[model samples]
Target: MTPARQKLLIVTRHTPLPWEDGAGAYLHDLARYLATDGFRVHILWLAPHDRLRWKKIWRLPAPFARAVRLHLPGALRLGRRFVFLAVVWLPFKARALDRVRRALNTVGLAPPRRHPSPAPPAAAPLWASPPTPAELALVVRFFEKHRPDVVITNYAWLCPILDLPALRRTCTACLTHDIGWQRAALSAPGIAPEITRDGEAAWLRRAALLVAISETDAAELAALAPAARVVVAPKACETRAPFAETTSRSLLFVGSDNAFNARGLDWFLREVWPRLLREVPDVSLHVCGSIDRLVTLCPDGVAFHGPVPDLAPCYRQAALVIVPLLQSTGLNIKLVEAAACGRAIVTTPAALPGAPFLRDAVAVAATPGEFAAAIRHLLDQPAVRAATAARALAAVRARLAPATCYGPLAALLRANAVARHDVARDLRVLHASGAHPPQP
Candidate 1:
């Protein structure tokens, strides 16, 4: 007998319509795969990244307009400041300091007469504003209209939409990229109690299921609500053709517009690459991604290919794929994709955390000097590169496949529906005893 089809509603801020970024690509693959498995999936995406384009398809009437109106002014105010800090503050500080130092050198100014560069300001406090009443109500209205049997959302920001006492009575799953309130609280030492207290914590505990992207992330959520069902689902990319290694002299780095990747690239370029270049004169670095700023800041010998739909060429033309990341909190999809393509990897400990590929096989580096040495060592030996490439591909095939990672996701969704029904009976008994007030 054929399996029964289930209806699902997926809510996300990003989904691949134009095949643009990582989140969109992941969502597209997920939706397609789920549909192929006999799911009737209806996706309600916010498409905040390309709002104008999405607006043309599903136009909202005036009632929905009034709901988002209250938060518009605050979002606009903070968003403007965010752009100024990123495009203006940080780069201006770097350039201004360079100019002042040059002037001091020309005038032969002593240390006492020279002024030091100012420290760049900290990143704007993340998620500083809570969702407006209008936004939350709009979500509830959308949910009622769709009346989905199951709901899956990517972030905790959608909590206000699904956290109603009545809504919690239904099946809800939160695919946590990161816990917004917890991240905000940790990123900023202290924030207003109103924003982080009952608001976010309540929504998290009420979630029927939580899907965490990494083990570390799962552990964090487990601590918050030990009884809540949770699953760890690692990110995966569709297999691409092997990147042919034509040169024993070039390295590759790729990412699009993430601050963490930008910092990672800067560290590699400034501290690691120069050391490798000294040992290998013909060494070339090819950058593929959408960060235009990195090109201007990159050294003279480096090459930049803005944005390529197919990343195979960048990997194909390399000696080895380099991941010199130090401080990112989640999985590095780039490292896994490179390994899947049978390319040799030289990465930092932070870059390969919980990754099985590096037990004794792939090269690991803890410092800039160590990373540089590893790159140099790999470049010099063809035999080591060949062996490393084979092992890297085998590890990814064994551990990083979608079926291996997402099994827990299916199990957790099933458990969430059961858990919600069980909890509802207990709540009713307590209310009847007058131990707690009835919730409507």
Candidate 2:
């Protein structure tokens, strides 16, 4: 008789959102690949626990509690998770977002409405606060019903729950989209460093595998939690044939309205966009995704198209794709996606944290002058552009197929998910970019 597919449950607060896509794209791809590779993959869209921990809530200023109280009635109408998430994340995000808007407002972009999100409790990052009774119950009930062989968490913050009765026997994994403390520190500077570090370290150490999107993260995470296994697996893009090039010198950029995108776009617009305009007088730059709202400038010859349902049309219309990232940690899915779409890309070193092999395949520049020059050269030289795009597409195909990227992970799961104590033999270095030995 054939054996049944082992069940895998992903406990995460993320779903694939078209607008803010990259953050969750790797998890979606992971689920898809694991399912294709013979596991019954199930996702639990975990939400914020109901009721803020009194220890955390009490440390906050009066208004924070007041805001929670004010939101509770309407939130009760919606649900408990709604109350927790909205009252906690929205106020902080809105306040921080508006602060950014206020700063950029000086640079000509209109500021959004202001809501004062005073300091949240010290040391509290997203699920770092103790999970609520309601949340624990939800997980327990879900586990009872599913009985998954493996429990994979979306972030290290959720790793604390691995000890719960329903999950104690299951092989646990944490998907590090980026380092949690680093992201939290950037998003909420008030969070204490020791708290973030200690909390992240404790839970990251708890996981059987810490799946990072980049090799850089794998190194960092391994150092942070020496006992845990760190595997590098990012989004896998299917490479297509080179797209038809156009005489149109249309440049395209797609990103969400986050600090990374804001910083990069602001820099590109202030420094590089003017130089490109001067060289190619008829050149037009197209901006897509929620980043349209966050950019500090909207100069002439630049157009903002808010989140669109389709990107193939945008990629097809472009002469090139630009990823002028100043700061980011994980694999920039856009870079791989652009390569997969058969478009030549121009980006900075900051964008290649995980996927360094593509440096030769695409144009890379650090400064404004060099970046502008690369974009200008790619625009003027169609043959060179075609050759570069072909190289990028080839690289994506050779290095990033789902099977190739996920094969090691499959082996790891088969070996470790059930009998986790036998880690000695299977814990060999296996890279997500098709760098592992063949089965005998």
Task: Please name the candidate that would achieve the greatest lDDT relative to the true structure.
Answer: 2
Q: How many residue pairs clash in each candidate?
A: 0, 0
- Note the residue pairs that clash in candidate 1: none
- For 227-278, candidate 1 gives per-residue lDDT tens digits of 7787887766555556565665888887666555676788888887788788
lDDT (Cα, tens digit) per residue for candidate 2, span 1-440: 12267778877755433234677567666776787787877766555223232112323233222222111212332322233445566679979987898888889977655677797754423544545565566678878976777788777777777878667557888888888677666654565553377678887887888888878888889988999888878778865566788778899999877778888999999999998898889999999887877775899999999877578889999999999998876788889999999999999998886788798999999999999999999999999999999999988898898887887887687667657423313444344345665677
Q: What lDDT would candidate 2 get against the real structure?
A: 0.75
TM-score of 1: 0.69
Please, what is the whole-model Cα lDDT of each candidate in the order they appear?
A: 0.64, 0.75
Question: Which parts of model 2 have CA positions greater than 4 angstroms off?
Answer: 1-3, 48-133, 183-195, 420-440
Candidate 2 RMSD to the correct structure: 14.0
Worst 10 residues of 2 by lDDT: 65-74
